[model samples]
Target: MQLHELEEFRLHAYENAKLYKKKTKRWHDKHIVSLTFEPGQLVLLFNLRLKLFPRKLQSKWSGLFEVVRMTQHGAMELKNKDKSSTFLVNGQRVKHYLRNDVDRELEALTLNDE
Candidate 1:
């Protein structure tokens, strides 16, 4: 009957949706990068307040905090440059701060006299 065909189509659609979700999740998890930090390394903390005040040119990360300690479960203790204050934040909420620590040699060009 027509009702039996419709039920079969619904069951097929449901199974396809479940398979799609599983494939998408596996792809996402494969691309994730795990971050590890050492003590005394500088890192930037993600600003959660940015979601409240969204701006086109505003930066999403704020502050340079030193890694004071890390817990086995992805929790980290961070301290500011002056060591004035310390706070515990999830490791997922921070990233390695990129600073130009490399020393590059500068080249000098000589001008030719006409």
Candidate 2:
């Protein structure tokens, strides 16, 4: 009888562990935001591997690169503003770069017709 109880307890424990993992995963995924980029859009690239003794106050993102192309396999081709260089990077490493002038331009266009 005791052996049967132990086996049942172990099964219950395993089920509880699976439930905990599922709840944790759901909570984590809820907080994650999906990012997308388009061609001609400017973006900042994240540098995952930073140099030793890097500047403490500096941002990990570098450059306002323009999206040259996107691939079906989740790769993005980016080019510098001067068109001097290009590189293919993973889409996960890039984020949209917002410029201050964009807001000004929008306000100007909205105020023009009135």
Candidate 3:
């Protein structure tokens, strides 16, 4: 085509590319897996101190705890398997299993424009 027409096409493409990039970044940030847990859901707790509990509390499978509270920073308050003790754990430390109700609700929320 004409030189001026080609230049205009390039400019339009560049603007669309910039807009898409901005939208993609926002979507990535929004879905960074910041989630909460309910009162009875089971989770695996991560131990921060490796040396303290070597035999019994080996930083994994310490207890099949139930969630007590959903805290800020995506953390949760957990009750021990025996219902004797409670602790606050970070989202990074806990892995939530598949629950049909909660999982469906999460899936229904529309993804951000990207």
Candidate 4:
């Protein structure tokens, strides 16, 4: 009788764990934003190296790299602006580089007023 009770409890616990895992996965997937890039697009690459001493104001991302090639496995080949250097990086570590269009627009407006 005691063995039957233990087996039932184990089964219940297993089901609860599976449900929890499914729920957690669903929640995580819901929050993840899908990112994609095209060849010739500019992007910034995230630096993963830990510095000996971190500066509070230093920017961690470094790039204005052009996407030279894209792989099916979520990797990208990036080239320097001058085309002198190239490297392959995971897409997860790169983000689209946003230009300061607003500032340029403001400057244009000011010039028109002048």
Candidate 5:
């Protein structure tokens, strides 16, 4: 009788664990924001080597690269303005980079009422 009880208890524990994992996955999926990038957009790549150098007061983000294309697996191919080099990185590692005068040029080109 004791052996049967032990087996039943183990099965109950497994069920609880499975339920906990399912609940955690649902919660995590809710919090994640899906981001999409487009070609020709300027973006900055996160510097993953910051911990290697450990410089004081150094920025954690690096480089302004144009998005040449997005891979089928969601990786982005980026190149600098000079097009000297290009590299592929996961989309999560990059963010859109906005210039200080991004809106200035659009505002400057006003249509005249003729």
Candidate 6:
């Protein structure tokens, strides 16, 4: 009787392992997301330094710019806000900022109407 119980436990463990493997494989086969950029687009540059840059320069998380050139397949060349310098950046380093641009434009238009 004890031997039969041990065999049943082993079988249960084997079935659970097979189910876990199937679930893991399903997760591994899931698709990943992708992003792309084009020239003349504006983007925010990511600064690795937790310390902030001077206000006249790029603030740690606030630097924004235009895409002056596309470098390697997934990289880009970005011109600084003042157009003084250009930087090469990987796709992972950039984030789209169109909403900010529209907000600024609307503010400018409203001010001009005043």
Question: Which pairs clash in the backbone of model 5?
Answer: none
lDDT of 1 by residue, 1-114 (tens): 999999999999999999999999999999999988999999999888736657889888988899999998999999999767888999999999989989999999999999
Deviation (Å) of 45 in candidate 6: 1.3
Better of 1 and 2 by lDDT: 1
Top lDDT model: 1
| lDDT for each candidate structure | 0.93, 0.90, 0.75, 0.91, 0.88, 0.76
User: On a 0 to 100 scale, what is the lDDT of residue 5 in model 4?
Assistant: 100
- Measured against the true structure, the TM-scores of the candidates, in listed sequence, are 0.77, 0.78, 0.45, 0.81, 0.77, 0.50
* Models ranked on lDDT: 1, 4, 2, 5, 6, 3
Runs with alpha carbons beyond 4 Å of true place in candidate 5: 50-56, 102-114
Model 2 regions lying over 4 Å from their true place: 102-114
Model 6 misplaced stretches (Cα beyond 4 Å)? 1-31, 52-60, 100-114
lDDT of 4 by residue, 56-107 (tens): 9999899689999999999999998976789899999999998877644334
Clash total of candidate 3:
0
Error of 3 at 51 (Å): 5.3
Please report the TM-score between candidate 2 and the true structure: 0.78
Clashing residue pairs, backbone N/CA/C < 3 A, model 3: none
Alpha carbon deviation, residue 70, candidate 4 (Å): 0.8
Q: What is the lDDT of residue 36 in candidate 2?
A: 80
Provide the clash count, candidate 5. Answer: 0
Task: Please give the distance, in angstroms, between residue 73's alpha carbon in candidate 5 and its true position after superposition.
Answer: 1.0
lDDT of 4 at 93: 95
**Model 5 C-alpha lDDT per residue in residues 1-114, reported as the tens digit of each score:** 999999999999999999999999999999998778889899998988637558789887888899999999889999998766888899999998978865544345778999
